[model samples]
Target: MYVEGLLSSLTRVKKARSLRAASWDTTGRNNDAWNIEPNETRVLADIKGPGCINHIWMTQRDGYRNVLLRAFWDDEEHPSVLCPLGDFFGLGNEIVNSYDSLLFSASTAGNNQFNTGCALNCYVQMPFNKSARIELVNEGDEMHRQYFYIDYELYEQPLDDEVAYFHTQFRRENPCDGWGHEIRVNTPEANIVNAERLAWDNNYLILEAEGRGHYIGCNLSITNFQGTWWGEGDDMIWVDGYKWPPDLHGTGSEDYLNQAWGMQPNAFRHNGSSIYEPDTDGYQTSYVFHLENPVRFEKEIRATIEHGHGNHLRNETSSVAYWYQLEPHKPFGILPVQQRKPVLRGEDGGWLINETAQTQQAEPTLNDEMKQLKAQWAEKQKTEA
Candidate 1:
C-alpha cells in the first residue's frame, strides 16, 4: 500500500519522514541549477531507503528529448527507469504541450517554451528497499542547466514484500518496417491474398518485459508518414507467453488511446491526446493509464501495436511504457543520442530513416488530394509554357 492521496489519508498517522533532494544553489545564490556538460551524467538523487519517492519536478532550458532520465532501484547495475525527459513526462518527439493528467503533467505559461516556462512533474510512487539512484544524462551538444526536486519519504519500517519497484523504458521505430503505402486501405488491392497476420513479430513493439509485473500505461507518439488517415493499426498485447490471439487486443490506435474516429485535442485524468495537430502533417501524442485496470503478467509481457492495419503504413513511432515489477529486470538498451532524437522529415515529406549512421529517405506516397494537385500543377506549367 502506498500513501498517495493526501486528502484521503490525512487522518491516518504514518511512520514516515518527508525528505527531498534538489538542485538548489549550494551557496544560497539565485543560480539554483546544475550546469551539466555535454555527455555528462549528473546524479540527481541517491537515496537509501525503506522508502518511496512521492513526487518529482523538473525544468530546464533545452531539456527536450536530448536529456535522458534514468533511475536505478536497490543499487541495480542497470536502470529500472530509462527514457527521454520529454517523453517520460507524457508527450513525445521533443514536443512540449501543456496538459494535466492524474499521474503526470507538464505546465507551460504560454507558447510552450522549454526555458523555465515548461514545468514537468511526476506523481507516481516509486518504492525501493536498499537504495535509489536517479540521474540525468545530457546528450545534447551544449551544456544544459537543470533544476529539479526529488521529494520522497523515509520509513523506519521495511517495505512490504509485495511492493513492486517502478520501471519504464522508451522505444522508437523511425519509419516502422511497414509495407508500401501506395494502395488505398480497405480496397480490394489493399486487402491482397493472404492478408491475415499470424505473427506479432512485425508490429511496433512498445514494451517487452521478463518477470512478474503489471503494465500501468504508456505514451505513444506518431508522426504520420503516408497520411490520409494514420491510425487503423490494432493494438495486441501478449501476457505470460501466450500464443497468437493475445489476451488483450484492441481495435485501432485511436481506440487504444481512448479516442474514436480520429485524434482530437483533449487531456483527461486517465486517457487523452496531449498534442494533436493535423496541420503539421499528423503529429499526435496520446496516453492511456491503467490506474484502475492494470494488465498483469506473471512470467513475461510483450506490448505492441500495428503500424497501420496489417502493418501497412510506414511512420515514425515512439513510446514510453510505465509499470511496476520485481527486481532483476530485463536490460533494454537505450538508443544512442542521435538515434533517439526525432527523425527529420526528408525533402520528399517522408522520414529520413536513420539506423546507426546508415541514412536513407523513405519513398514518399501522396494521398488522393495531393496527387490531384500534382496533376493540376503540371497542367498549369504546360499551359504557361
Candidate 2:
C-alpha cells in the first residue's frame, strides 16, 4: 500500500528552512517567540522557489482575529493567501478548541490544558517554481507574541509548471443583504432573471478566481440573531463560464458538507461541525476538506450561496476559502477588521490571559505512534538484557 517515490532514491538533497523568533541571539533559551508590535508587518517566510512547503506550525497569544496572515507565491505583488491567522488554519471563531483533520488541526499543548494558547499545524503542500513570500500582520491595539516554523523541501526534481499555487481568502457579511417580510426593490425585475428566483443577486460569495485549479474546501462560521434556521440556504458554485444557477448546486448548508438534519458539535476526521456557541440563538462552525474530492475548474470559478431560501433570511456569516491555482493568480481583498469580526449571539467571548496546566485535572495522553514506539523500545531493552 505504501510504495516509495523517485525522491526516495535520490542520493543527495538540500533543505532550507527558518524558525523565526524575536530573540534569535538567545540560542533557544530565554526568548523564542517574536513579540509583534501593533501595525507591524513581520515577514515569516521569504524562500527561493524550486521548493514546496510541506508543513507549517505556529503558536500565538491573544488577539487571534487581530493577527492577519498572508502569503504570496511566485514572487507575486499581491498575496495569494490572506485571512486571520486563526481562521486560516480552521480556527474560525478565533477561540481554540482541539480538533483534528487531515490537512489542518490545532491542539492545547498541555494535554488538553490551556497552558499553550494553541499549537497549530497545517499540512497543505504549497509548491512554487519561482519564489514564496509569507507575512504576519498585527493589527490589534496591542502587541502579541507569535512563534512559527516553516518546514519545506528543496526538491531534487524541478517543480512542474502545472503545479498550482495555494491560496486562501476571507469574507464576512453581517446580516447579509436580504429581503425580509418587507421588500424594497421591485419584485418583477428581481424575478425576471428566471421567472422565479431564490436570490435576486445578493448571494454570499466565498471565492471568485480565474485560473486552472481545484478547490480545497472552506471553513464556515455563522451566528444567527433570528429564530430561523441559518442553514436554509444552499451552496452554489459557478465554474468556468457558467452564469446564474451555478454548475454545482447544493441542497442545504448542512447537506452541502454532508451533514444532515441540523448541525451538531463534533470533530470528525474529514468533515463535521465543531463549535456551537455560548448561545443557542444561532452560533455554529463547520468545516469540510475536499481532500479526496476537490472541485476542479479550468478557466474561472465563482463560489457562493444564499443567506436563506431566496436571500430572505438575515444572519452573520464568515468564511475562509482554500484553493490552488496557476501563477499570477487574481488578487483578492481582505475586509477591514471592523467588518471582519463576527456578530456573536450575546456578549463577546473573552479568553483567560494566564492559563496553567493546573486547571486541567486529567492527565494528557500520548498519541498512538508515540505509544507504539515506547512499547517497541521497552521490548528491545528486554531482549538486549
lDDT of 1 by residue, 1-385 (tens): 6667636667779889999999998897989989999999999999998899999999875667888999999989999999999889986777677899999998775433333447889999999999999999999899988889999999898888789999999988777766545444554433422122443666788999999989999999887766677777788989998676788989888899888987777899999977675634557789999888999989999998877776666677889999999878999988777776765667887667666733234544444544554455556558869
- In model 2, where is the ten-residue run with the lowest total lDDT? 352-361
Model 2 residue runs over 4 Å out of place are 1-26, 109-116, 181-200, 278-281, 344-385
Clashes found in each candidate (C-alpha, N, C closer than 3 A): 0, 1
Worst 10 residues of 1 by lDDT: 187-196
Question: Each candidate's lDDT (Cα)?
Answer: 0.80, 0.69
Q: After superposition, how far is residue 69 of candidate 2 from its true place, in Å?
A: 0.5
- Candidate 2, residues 28-60, lDDT tens digits: the string is 576778888989998978877678888889887
Reference-based lDDT, residue 113, model 2? 24
| Model number with the top TM-score | 1
